[model samples]
Target: MRQMRMSHDEPLLAIDGLKTHFFTREGTVRAVDGVSLTVPRGKTVCVVGESGCGKSVTARSVLGLVDEPGRIIDGRIAWQPGAGEPVDLTTLDPKGERMRRIRGGEISMVFQEPMASLSPMYTIGDQLIETIRLHLPLGKEEARDRAVEQLRRVGIPRPEERLDAYSFQLSGGMCQRVMIAIALAADPALLIADEPTTALDVTTQARIIDLLRDLQAETGMSVLFITHDLGVVAEIADEVVVMYLGTVVERGGVDEIFHDPKHPYTNALLGSIPRMGAGAGRRLATIRGNVPHPSDRPAGCPFHPRCDAAIGGVCDVSDPPHIVFGEARSVRCVLHDDGAAVGGDFRVDGERA
Candidate 1:
């Protein structure tokens, strides 16, 4: 994590062995399984994985957004919450008044699709004001003022006038910015953004990232940004968590995970990233197999079949112990076995039977 540039203070929020599962007709599907992570004050952690990797489920669980069939059957989400002990958010029911208060008041989330997250019937200004008033005991006029200020802070041009416009009236990028403003309206301690830039163009995405970074620095808010883009993870994440089939296979600072990736899954994900300019003309690398569906997860290590360096019998029969490379790095893979081409802490092979 040295390259990721962290301050090393205690985290504002910490997730410990969290699991989110859904009860379907067949069986329970584990979406987030025994995952642990921490977001320090003013630091960002990017949870990167392809679709259906449980990244969204993990984020939703934090905000109590999982509903109906999905449930937080295991683990704890502890938040610093100003000056309190790490409060376990999983114990709070979403509909309960206290949990409701905590959702938008202490913690906020912006969905991947701004259009879907925003009410089509409400004007942008009305929605922003509603969010502010929902958490704060401010009067209508004060809340409206805060809304306009937040809109302006997010770089929404002529925010006062545009506040009256509906969702359809604004472009995708503008709508995304409005979502950002809505999240900021409450001055929350943590922000969970799930693929927030999916609707915007590349340049607009960069601008949004810049705006978010600036706002986080100014407010000292911890952000859990959920995205599949390694490039985005590289640029914005102070720490990284890589997931596969509802499990965290690797966790470290952005530099350690990306530059010195130890897990085969992490290596495969990094290999798939396209290199341009100096690496031009080189064909893009690809990971052949698709992510396993929750209903039919492979036995043993979920990633063994796809891992090129897997030790035949070991990965086929058992899950590897999580190996710690340093204070800032850890990986879950049998490749950590001693004398491996890429080494960490692998056991010596016993003599042949």
Candidate 2:
């Protein structure tokens, strides 16, 4: 067998052509169709898209959390654990022992709804201790102490007291903090946070983002953050992947995606971000049309229907290739096709192309 070498350039997680589909009674719902991205070690990679764009499904698929009727049908999820071999996560059984060890031990996730994630029956301390003990070879007392420390690490006030409290006792922000604490209890190398700030207030959201950053800095762990909010992406992301429908439309560094978005969908998303000093009466830019249903997804370029830069008989007729722009940026659009104009800024007024 060939040995897997861990180089500095190797990504902590590399997903390629991932197709997570749900076989419903009506038809197959291609929730995450051929989505690919990478989370480098010690860096934050944010996947941004509107609702129903398969952002959550992609995150769930990463941890083998996709429920029944849905399964990862294709591609490989290469997960590099330290200097050891890179394991293919997609090939593992969802409920099998190896995956169990990998899920919470190698990679942990903080979900969107903290209240729902935490059990109402169990006290926070019990839950945290259980998770810690499950992943680590710690006795009950040691796990309990570690749980308290993890709570403190996440900035939960009076960590020892809060540990014994139920999930209902904590506010929304505090509940989220506890979720992060649980995720960190194992000291996983990769942390997958799925909209951890969606329901939080602005200040609380900022705090949560900062907390994650601090934790990453302390642990040197990579993060795969899934959110629709570009503001949060801008605040924390080192790399950004823009998903539309079920595929990655564009992906680049944070500044590249924000300043020079090539895909129409990406450009529209960047324009939609609210500015601080906008005119009082100006309306925020909005992307027109809704995300197409999985069953009713359009042929060829999935985004061509609403894309202003879409060329007639071209974009709707054939799928565009992944246009590579140097090493850090890649876009999926017809405007960047061979012999097509691939320079300058992308305007949404139907005039750029």
Candidate 3:
């Protein structure tokens, strides 16, 4: 594997003002709007949000995988390859050689649906070996050996025997493991796991999370994990980013997010999680409404309508100011504006007051 020359202070990936939109007959859908975050070297950053909050789209945007009608209209994705100066991924042609090489070779992704991602037409071995050869200069036999090693590394049983098995032949958890094996075949510096454990059973999900953590420790790869499960975030996230309606609502350390959430949306989400040892008849808490459709987004603060602490005239009329507490901690909310609630001067530019 290649050594990363990046220093401890520099982040492995930095995204700034990313805006991905889909132009359709009905209207333009802003899937990811002005989203900014960073993934530190060899650490897990979990992007947590409800469905339709653009978590998957944001992950896809990083890999240049957004499909037709959907285009990355604005942004800068600075990728530090640990050698030369950082490369701006947003400028590369999606289908060009450099982007293609970087997509699976440098930054691999384990897609949401393992079965849908793996092809039933080919044996798992064929898929894995193909991926290995695409990025690594290895003979067919060597690639096959590497594929088996990857499967074994991911905890698949009877690695050699399973290599010839088709995606439909394996269980959901097993297929997910295979997808992970393919993703890791080239030893990518960064792994984008888009809800990889969502379709698995509780036990399987835990195992997958453990496997990823262990692999990260072994390979020193950064993980950008996208999920709605705060439980999973608590398990693996070094930093947590909360998204709402295509924009980041809050971001901070995992402990800070869970213990001292600032944004009303973040507080509501934490409240909605089922707690243990509650009274027998106690009802679970829930957020009031569904995420608004992108095309029908509300005016001003996107979350104002659902936020309980919203300043009616202010939040509904103007965009919430971005308030920064310190490096790596920020919230976008009118309540946090200076003298309003938290007593911090809010900046429209997301700078510290």
Instruction: Write down the lDDT of every candidate, Cα atoms only.
Output: 0.83, 0.89, 0.91
Q: Which window of 10 residues has the lowest lDDT sum in candidate 2? A: 340-349
Question: What lDDT is obtained when candidate 2 is compared to the true structure?
Answer: 0.89
* lDDT of candidate 1 over 181-236, digit per residue (tens): 99888889889999999878999999989999999989988899999988889899
lDDT of 2 by residue, 17-117 (tens): 99999999999999999999999989999999989999999999988999999999998888887676788888888899999999889899999999999
Error of 2 at 343 (Å): 14
**Candidate 1 vs 3: which has more TM-score:** 3
In the predicted model 2, the residue pairs found to clash are none
TM-score of each: 0.91, 0.95, 0.94
Better of 2 and 3 by lDDT: 3
Residue 101, model 2: lDDT of 95
Clashing pairs in 1: 337-346, 338-346
Screening candidate 3 with a backbone cut-off below 3 angstroms (N, C-alpha, C), the clashing residue pairs are none
Model 1's alpha-carbon lDDT is 0.83
